[model samples]
Target: MTTTEIAPAPAAAPARAAHLYQLDLYRVITFALVILMHVLGATTFPQDVVSDALETPLHLTREAFFALTTFVLVFSYRSRPPRPMAFWRRRVPLVAVPYVVWSVLYWGYSLLTAEQPVGSVAAALRALGIEIANGTAWYHLYFLLVTLQVYLLFPVLMKLVRTLERRPWLVLGISGAVQIAVTCFLSYPPEGVEYSTVSRFFTTLLPYQFYSVLGAVAAVHFEAVQAWVRRHRWFVAGGLVVTLAVAETGYFVSVHNGLWPELASDAFRPYLVPWCVAAIAGLFLVGTRWAEAGRRGGRVVSWAVDRSFAIFLTHPLALALLRPLIAFVGDGVGAPWTTVVVYPATVALTLVIVEVLRRLPWSKALTGRPPLELKRAAATAAA
Candidate 1:
């Protein structure tokens, strides 16, 4: 009599997953920053005093891109069924073809221009198998190699992350501790710790691997991060401001006072941890809430997002065309403002070129396709 028939309260509608457009816009913005960093990095601005002052933020910008890459990869792969072989098959061609093409281009250029006895074709082949001493383009290829390593390890890492996500505070505490330890260890080197390629690889790869794994783990608890970001946007902003201020202050104090030579030279590394966190938080906030706020962002964002992969692949050739101008402009003119102008110009020009090439008859193969016509023919034959 007290309760006629107490019905259970209806479950709340499942929270709608955020739109992909938001992530897409974030990707475009981050990639544009990556392009800017590369363009400026290739110039001489980083070594100058005023430029160094400006370049701290730019350095953060680039590391933020790398951090975003790790973050996005985690988000993209989480809960997606594992496809290890498919992953390799897709990424290998994307990475290997461009790498080989660029390697040869650089090798040929070196042979034509260098003063020393350059390696023969046979030697070049051997070097490529084990090392890439003469391949300037190989600098960027290292990330591809590292990304492949991360992909290979992802399934195992994902399992661990799933287990950890249930106790997010525990996961964060452990990861943060490990990251701090690694950073501290890296901050100081023993006398015999040579700075050769092998040593450098081990040092850099170890820390980067930790961050990448942390990113994968974080993906599992992204909802928690999203919630925190929403509630503490100002706190996040304050964290960023504090991080940048400390970084900039350290840079100037070191440059002027000539204290902590190693620390000063390696200021970029300290900023990495803070900047990565801030960028991820910033992107999450914008992506979840503000992605569609601006009118100009809609079509432009869509275009940039669609073209990002292709543009990343082909933009180096465009940069090569501009290298002569960059060289002529000299170190004096390679300021942040110069880069602010040139980097976007280069990206725009590259996008235009790629668009034009897409319209050509044989453009498909050059751009990693068999051709639209060939695809149709294959479909018909299969049917």
Candidate 2:
């Protein structure tokens, strides 16, 4: 008798479920920072010492959000087998729906308010090239487009990273070198060549590709990094202090030397290296320590985390509504603490609005699901 041995089935893929509490807190903090950055961008404070000091923190804030995006995306999806259809189902609507809606809304507003002639549909089509000229909208939406590309490439990227998981330091070295090379190239601003849309997309995204790939690598070796952070918390903290000081000094020197004109245009790529690394280190150090803190005072963080995404999508609208109030405070009629008061108030108001919207019937598609209502309905069905 000949006996044939059968190989056991490959182990089932890990569940995709993520801890809501942890993600929600991250979302809250990052989205709040996004809104605060936008608010700062809109306002024109006196260019004095106080304004410079206040603006420094805001400069670092949104970089934290970008780095957090990489961190969360990597961790949440690392174990799950790739499902391109499912991935697009979740991400595309979240991004494209908002993009289309906001684009039309802003376009209509511009038509109504601006002195430029409202053109025919054909003329508007022609002007599509220049639609982004004003820079009022999140010029940063290009990042979302880059993120979509990264998601599409995740499976291949993840496989490659997993193969090198045993040599994480090598992966880090390669990624860091690529990132520095890309930054150096981008910093030299191409001369005499008109940047086409395709060129522009590649130019903007090349830097972030490094982070996204590094993040996947980091995910496979997360335990190692977490341990390192815990063991070297002070070192990580010192690195952050030094990085921030250098970035601020760079900003001042650029301003003094009239390089502000060159740097004023927001190019996300170059800044990603230093600012993002600092933000990631700081966040990792904090997260590891917080996890070790045994869940005490976790609720506050959880609340912020839960409301983060909705706030990100809806806070622009909220800020538009609050613009007049912001102007009122900044106009010197209010107390010296106007900025301090208005900033927190803006976040609280946006959170309240997001919470309310998350419960509405029409809003469910946008805000994921209504947790309490769904739970009650399920209970009723069971009963």
Candidate 3:
């Protein structure tokens, strides 16, 4: 669906920076939520040690948060439209460098942990190629891969956004329908059928096209959406609650029937789209109130948000290293309580580690943080 009509792009003015802090709050909260989801995930793998009622809802929240990343990306891009090639030159390196570095790190970790065996250099390279291609080097790295894919076609996405500006519902409707089809087709497969290659590609970018496109439309029309959300704040909040209930119910029913044991746990399930959209809108409205709190609130919130991407890259490692401690706590608190404790502990530990990593030479290439002064000095010396 193409439209020749273009609506005026919204200005991301500097004076309204505080208003944008709501987005930062969303980022920080969602980053923590993702870590929590992964923590809960540990219960189901290799052994089904603990099952919690919170799992489906938390898992869905993590997937829903993908919209925040795209929203921020497109919002920043429209604020300062870059030359297409220049955009790639500047942004691709930020993701690619870290992706390669972390892939190597996770591969080496796998070898040390006996998950992968030592092999010839050529074999190791080949294995690494597969891991990077499938975003299997680590659990969370797929987000980087997906974002990179989206970045490659970002210009075209913006163009589509421009075309649909006058008819925003058309944008959401098309992307939403495709997302639903993709989600259901992928989630409810025939028994014992394999689609490894297709699954990997789906994991990358296509399933999330709706979120990215809708995010761009939201970015250009932020004020209008924000105003509508405020007027219907209670309705938005209720919608989120209702959708989450439906999703959780559907997931439990599927598991009880033994159809696809945890099929609905997959992030892209058709039921999750409504939940994601509602949750984001509800949270955005709540976050704006927090943004208006005070200067200290702003600093504290922004500080955490600034480190979120870095935290995302480093959190899995944090989770791995903390497993022994988690096991100890789990013995006493039980697995569910362990998850509750694990989420914040991991977040705190990851941020501390990331702070140190950010100060090290050339470490942004791994942590996804902006290079600090030490890195700058190292670069100057190398030059």
> Which candidate leads in TM-score?
3
Measured with C-alpha atoms, the lDDT of residue 315 in candidate 2 is: 65
Looking at candidate 2, the ten consecutive residues that score lowest on lDDT are: 1-10
lDDT of 3 by residue, 133-235 (tens): 8888988888888878878888776666566568888778888888888777788666675777447656567777777777777877776877787689889
Candidate 1 lDDT, 172-228, residue by residue in tens: 677677766666556555567755632454324455654565566556666665567
Best by lDDT: 3
Model 3, residue 362: displacement in angstroms?
A: 0.9
User: Clashing residue pairs in candidate 2, if any?
Assistant: 24-305, 24-306, 25-305
Better lDDT candidate (1, 2): 1
Model 3, position 308, has a per-residue lDDT of 74
Quote the lDDT for 301 in model 1.
70
How good is model 3 by TM-score?
0.87
Candidate 3: the clashing residue pairs are none
TM-score for all models, in order of appearance: 0.77, 0.78, 0.87
TM-score, candidate 2, is 0.78
What would the C-alpha RMSD of candidate 1 be, to one decimal place? 7.7
For candidate 2, write residues 150-225 as lDDT tens digits: 6566556656756656777787788778877766566554676454532453424466656665556656666666
Taken over the whole model, the C-alpha lDDT of each candidate is 0.58, 0.57, 0.72
Better of 1 and 2 by TM-score: 2
